[model samples]
Target: MKWFEIALVVLTLGSGLVLLLDKLFLAKRRATKGGLLDSEEPALVDYSRAFFPVLAVVLVLRSFIAEPYKIPSSSMMPNLLIGDFILVNKFAYGIRLPITNTKVIPTGEPRRGDVVVFQFPGHPDMPGDPQRGENFIKRVIGLPGDRIGFHGDTLSINGQPLAYEVKGEYVGKGRGAEMNGATLLSEALPGRTHTVLEYLGRANPAGQGDWQVPQGQYLVMGDNRDNSDDGRFWGFLPEQNLRGKAFLIWLNCSGWFCKDGFEPSRIGSGIQ
Candidate 1:
């Protein structure tokens, strides 16, 4: 479990214990006229009791409503930037028990073209253990039972070529300057259109045929096509591994991840 979650649990439990002990002490003092008078000891209930309600609300909101995540990679660059702090709607996919990640309430299923946060399948960090909380953000390319293909740098789905509009050479700003001359383009999915980067000089690695997504699984890829380690490298994403849908960028502290120190313009924009 994350340290924040552990702290929240500890705080909630500590608050409850304080309240219970306070009630018990009050009852004991009431039974006797001078039972452990105030002169004998400090207040049994700590100030934590005063913050119980606030802490509980924060815990619930973070666990079941929305949770904050930091983008650690540039897989979804141009849409999500490294060092960008985003809010993932926890209940967007389903109401799963926090920490354990076992889904108990069905909210909604992910659709094609939706940028989502999910546990990367077979990723070393994403073990069978749910407590690891390993997650990756990427665009849903092929839904379950759908066929997706990539020819050279072109994408085709179900035997039809996807429309790709060239958007000139990309000029990288931070660590992304590594791809300063990569080709930029716009890709239109079924329900959404988003910008993408393609390094035309990179050779395809054993990628000539279609990808057959299995049942209860999805095929995801990054917007930074050539640099991404996605479905092509890790295989399909299991449905049960979904975390939530990434919807908003709440803050941006470029820090060591980017050459820019802070990007104020990215905040408040919806993740497309």
Candidate 2:
């Protein structure tokens, strides 16, 4: 479990338990001891009572409905930018329990071209130990039992080459300015079309490969093809590691040190 999820669960359960114990045992005991202020609740009980409801509501909403995330990298550039505060539909793929991440209810599977936030399958910090990695956002390129290939900045799915239309040279702003000269292209991924960035004149030997997606895994790639460290470098993503589908950018802030950090135009924009 992430640190935030662990803390939220602990605080919520602790407060609720305190409130329950006070009502069931402590309050009754105080009432029997005549002179002991039966009507006055203890400080801990009072605080628990005041906070339990609010915490419980937030827990439910965040765990089951939707949750917010901040984009700290340019993996999905041109679509999801650095400092973009996005919303993920928690129940879009399935209804999973908090911390444990066990899917109690099946909702729907992810589609091709869908932007998804998932736990990185590889442990970069502790290599060779198969632990859950940090959350990563990417676009689903291949589904189960599919043939996915990539070479020369072009993508092929199931032996069919997808078309790429050169839009123009990308001119990025803020933190994205580093990718100013990247070639912007519109990729036709089956039913969807999305913008992608590639350094046209450069070689991406590491990203050139082909793979057969297994029955319980997926193939994902970053929109910033040349700059992203994704499935191309690691391997296929296990379906169980998936968190949810990213659908919206609710806020954007450049950085804490930057003046006028807020980018109001990106707010309330839907993620394609």
Pairs with steric clashes in candidate 2: none
RMSD vs true structure, all candidates = 3.4, 2.0
Worst 10 residues of 1 by lDDT: 37-46
**What does candidate 1's lDDT look like per residue over 196-233, in tens digits?**
98877574665445799999899999998877778877
Clashing pairs in 1: none
User: Stretches of candidate 1 above 4 Å error?
Assistant: 21-44, 124-132, 206-209, 256-260
Candidate 2: segments with Cα more than 4 A from true spot: 35-39, 123-132, 257-260
Of the candidates shown, which would achieve the greatest lDDT relative to the real structure? 2
What's the count of clashing pairs in each model shown?
A: 0, 0
lDDT agreement of model 2 with the native: 0.88
